[model samples]
Target: MSLRIDVAGLRPERVSVAPSPLAELGMALHALAEPGHHPGLQGWVTAVTAGLDPHLADRMCEADFLWRTTFSDLFLPCAGIPGRTALPGATLADELDLLDKLTDEQFVDCALEFICAPGYDLPSAGVVSDPELRRRAFDLAATRGPRQVRFTRRLLDDPPRVRAWLRQFLRDCDEAFFADVWARVRPPLAADARLKTDLLRRKGLAETLTSVSSAVTLDEEAARITVDKLVVGRSATGDGGLLLVPTSLGWPHLMVLHRYGWQPVLHYPVGSPEPAAPPSVEQLALRMTALSHPVRMRICRMLARSAYTTTELAQVHGVSAPEISRHLTLLKKAGLVTTRRRGRYLLHQLDVAVVARLGSDFLEGILR
Candidate 1:
């Protein structure tokens, strides 16, 4: 059965600050100036600025770019290189070609090598054919467990190479195969209709469509809105459709929705605001207080990698079981970890989604 819900109406009840008017205006000005930053602001700006003077538009665009630079530095400190200015002389097609080249396999490889080298346990290069590679992959996976090594060794023998190979493979595959592969790779995005709805709700139809159209050329905004209005109960919507929005704030925001078939619904949207929820004072206090203790933080990191019983955690941390349990209690109270009873043993695992939201909130507070 298929189901759907309008996300705009389902927004979390706890109100957080909307992006400030100044921020919005600044973003608009940047969109007019650089054109690149406007990816998120695209259709909305076009819709809003329909009758403005051309020269005034140009000035606003420059201001928009400046704000984009400032906001990015503050909010997305780890954002990849900002692309070249897309101005009057540059066409959207040209900017897109540049974006494609920017995030190509070579660049992705470089990024993986840089960011993942410290945490990477498996060997690099042609590990696909080597028995040693398979052994190491299994050992690494077993030691670190499922959460850390989400993909099988066969799928991740050489992380960078595998990702690149898979990208090309998907490009060549038929729709059915693509859908299967996508499900395996991004089950969270696939399973959660709320993620799609929230994105569309936060970024209205026009802007979402403009950004996505720049990349994949499909009209995802319309499809998503249509689905939102059509899908039935929440449970039924689970099978309704699958739409993959862009991964980041660039030209090709790949928007794919599952509308019964394996075909992808692609789009290019200007930008998307991070989906988040505000932490309660108790939650905030817990996270902040927990960070003050190195032992607790280390325990949190271990839990992030995999679930462990109190005894297992104690063994891994080289501490007594009671000590581990005490820390675990604090973590559980903070909503950073969850516990499930497995016979006589209680297994503890990180609450990743909640942790991510909390982390974002904490950072935003610190930065502000």
Candidate 2:
């Protein structure tokens, strides 16, 4: 549904982090199920998905028109999600059926009669006048244009089709992806929720909201939190407030949607993984060890001035080339340095951005 986004000024106490409900999980899973539908996703699908049915993937992708005009983001509830920290008891079928009913009655007018603002007015928002609804319709129609309005109207007229299509789409995904991948996804997703809760307790709301993901950031003057998404439309926040859901399938990105006719919710990948986790733990140790030695720090400083070769550095330090080589290896593993081979010499240069961000971004100061 035009990748709906609702804007709000959320107070510290009002903001919360939650694990996605089963229904919401279905939506995120749908986003990734069809790699063939979007060429860009093929590599991602191949890398992460095991034993995926090629035909099913294509079918799921086609169901959303390959995310061409409108998508199933409308099906998931933006407000009143049942679970606080784990998946809701609702089965996939239960979720699909509930959405079908909502779209049948609650969203019918907004889809057909209302065209401009195209705002999804939740029944929970209470009754609104026809004139205001019409105004919103016109606003939305103007933003999305006629083609999308027509497409959405057609779907509203036939809610069963969308429901059936989604039911099958999720079933196929469950077999190939979700059934296997969901367990691994659970802990990380919960950890992310806990991390935000802790951040809210420790750093307060403003900082936690800003650090939620790269895609979400706060506007200073208005206290408006803008979440970046594929589509562009401005939506007012509902009484239900903002919902922050940590996503497992949606890694390295963010999603903003108006819950069809509910509150605005932001689904984003979890940020700042726990240091105790497997590879991350080892990686952290490497970075700490690399930054600890004085000789390496001097080498980093020198490289920042200009790229240098091992022999040149060894000559300056009055050490053997092998020792400089060893130090450079450690720095590279720490992500503090990068190298480009120029004939016989491997030119080493400091990763200035990495080093600079170490003070804030990579938890280096926290590690200390």
Model 1, span 1-368: residue lDDT tens: 12232223222221111111112222333344445443554774565457555654453332132243322111111112232111110222232233244333223222233112212222223344557754665565556445334444424444555445433322332131223323332343222334444555686443443333321222334332332111122211122222233222222112222222121222222234423234533456677786578988888898899888988888888999988888888888887889999898889999888777775555433321
Candidate 1: minimum summed lDDT over ten consecutive residues — where? 72-81
lDDT computed for candidate 2: 0.56
Name the TM-score of candidate 1.
Answer: 0.30
Error of 1 at 193 (Å): 26
Per-residue alpha-carbon lDDT of model 2 for 120-212, expressed as tens digits?
Answer: 443332213355544554456556566645545444446566456656766676666665556666788778888888997898655776677
Q: Provide backbone clash counts, one per model.
A: 28, 12
Provide the clash count, candidate 1: 28
Top TM-score model: 2
- The local distance difference test score of each candidate is 0.40, 0.56
Cα lDDT for residue 271, model 2? 42
Model 2 Cα shift for residue 190 (angstroms): 1.2
The candidate that achieves the highest lDDT relative to the unseen native structure: 2
